[model samples]
Target: MPTTPVVSRRRVMAALFTGVACMNIAMAGASTAGVLIATESPGPGWSGVPSAAGVLGTAAGALGSARLVVSHGRRRSLLITYGLGSFGALLAAAGAVTGLFPVLLVGLLVLGLGNGGAQLSRYAAADLYPDERKGQALSAIVWAGTVGALAGPPLIAPAARTADLLGLPGLAGPLLVAALVTAAAAVVSAALPRSIPDAHPRTPETSGSEGFAVAFAQRAVRGPLLAMVAAQVAMVAMMTMSAPQLHQHGHGLDVVGWILTAHMIGMFALAPLSGRIADRWGGRVTIFAGIGTLAVASAAAVAAPTSHTAGIPLSLFLLGYGWNLVFVGGSSLLSTQHRKLQGTVDAVVWSTSALAGLAAGPLFALGGYVLVAVVAGVAALIPLVALTDH
Candidate 1:
């Protein structure tokens, strides 16, 4: 159920785009920094911990945001989520400064919450448009990540340099920048026009474990849910391992950064086109394309060594676009669902991705990147069987 807006749809949409871009920039910087920062700690392995924490936080945030929207509406939900994101960033910075992995992980978790909020902004965009235009609306918000993709990696060096000069951890700079920008993102949340409240606010009886059970019980919800989860699991598992894989192969942060940039571009740059495909050819076709590309990406990763010039980066790029397809396709499938389901769907997706993140390290350790890629390719296939004309 969407609330009627007092303001023009375009104004609200612009704010959503801007707010998403800001979150992406912060996330991009923090992701690299988090990896580098975590590596500094001495332990059995931090590979899965940081990404897992962030993703878990994302799952929590997604769930919380949906319930919040049901009662208070989208704008209020955005405000709360971004605010938590900002505080979480600062907490992460403190962790960096004190050389405490626990603190850093906690901060990352909170920051993930904010990111989770940003992720659902696409659904907020969905409320403004009709079903016919939902794909484009979702894509417009998703494409905003391209800004982060291009701008984020470049900031790593300069932000780290600033940190070094400030006598802080070299990697702390990006986290600090993340903190600042996420704060701004919270302010941007205010720009979203207020939503007309649902006729009846969701009571605890209708919104907790019972609520989720009811929503998940619907047969129509299951297909898109599986597709969403598959994309996230495959993408997150491969991605969580990519940086460490590169570092192990003697690639520097600069190379890792460049590769990530390519990956982000693939994830976001052509979102409009993907959205159009969903709109024109239908989400089933769009989802098929995503699943196919993910398989190819996995095979590509296996076909060549990490050092191969184009193999890893190009594979990652395809992987990103593949995730995009499923993401857009999945969301578009839900355009007709009760808006209450958006948050839960996103929560499930991120939650599985968190598990995927946790699993990547062990999988890599056992059979190396090949095994992880294989796992991802296999996950993509699960949804293919469930997808229908919808």
Candidate 2:
């Protein structure tokens, strides 16, 4: 049976803070690639390593989550996530200091595994609320992370400079700060109420692998999953390429930081209320609106990279906001569809999104910004069309 609706604002705040810490650490790993590629010529083909690390981490985490979903359950899995992530952050920092690419790869892989697990933690947040308000709870968790994402780069900036002063690579300093963030997340995770154990209540009709199979085969699950998969690819591709896109157009890293912050603001600022829209309007309506927003954002980005005058920031902001809507809506739908089999559905969602992102990076590199934006826009249109037709 579903739990009571006891998610007070205070509890929501606490949970959001916990999630934010974990997300901050997870996202900080991504900046490592940019830092590495910029600071050191890692030779040709190595430019993609950091992004690969993130993907690999996500994959590992997803797989681990799958195993835990069947075995120890969600809460225990998250505990392992924070614990391993803390160690991975430390190891990555050490590898950066020593300039050991191999070690860095290993460390990042561990971090990625942790990331996969942390991603599922958002679902745990949703479970804290009642079915009617699950989307709102999920959005609150995402919104909490928005602050960390905005501040993430600056957090490591000073450390990077200090590392440079101390005759160490700047990546070293950022890794250290990331470690602290991970540790903090671990402490927060410790505070989560353990009242509800990992697995949802099982029944003859909705238990085990058979239940998962049935859910996936259903038409309702398919629509949301398809929409979610496409939206994830576009959002990840745009965000991944933003730095390069900005750089090519004569904007510095600082500008990229500001743009990212604006994007975060766009997503987080509206999150509190966006989920409520899902509650009132249904996920399908919100999903279409979200995709439309992304389509506009993508078109704007493709048409004008040099035009940073309000338009660029506004476009990116819309893009971010659109992503939040799609994610929240898609997730809400999944929760509704799977109900008892949420953990399994979440695994599929994360895996699909990660695979899409993994594919997006190389596509962006080969096709460049214009082509990538077009691809993302086209992809966004698929969901829009589907939703409109329905």
Winning candidate number (lDDT): 1
Residue 101 displacement (Å), model 2: 3.3
Q: Give the residue spans of candidate 1 off by over 4 A.
A: 1-7, 196-211, 217-219, 388-390
Q: TM per model?
A: 0.92, 0.85
Query: What RMSD value applies to candidate 1?
Result: 3.1
> Every model's Cα RMSD, please?
3.1, 3.4
Task: Give the per-residue lDDT digits (tens) of candidate 2, residues 1-390.
Answer: 645444543553475457565555456534544434532456422444555565567666766665675576555676687678768777777777777777776776676666666666556666566677777877777677576656775555566777789888765776776777777776776666554432244432444435656666666776776777677767766666666656667775457667777776776668767789888887887788888889998988888855666766777788888887887787778664333355455555555555555555566567766676788788877855455444
In candidate 1, what are the lDDT values of residues 46-157, reduced to their tens digit? 6767888889999999889877877887789889999999999899999989988889889989999988888988877776676777899889999999998998877887
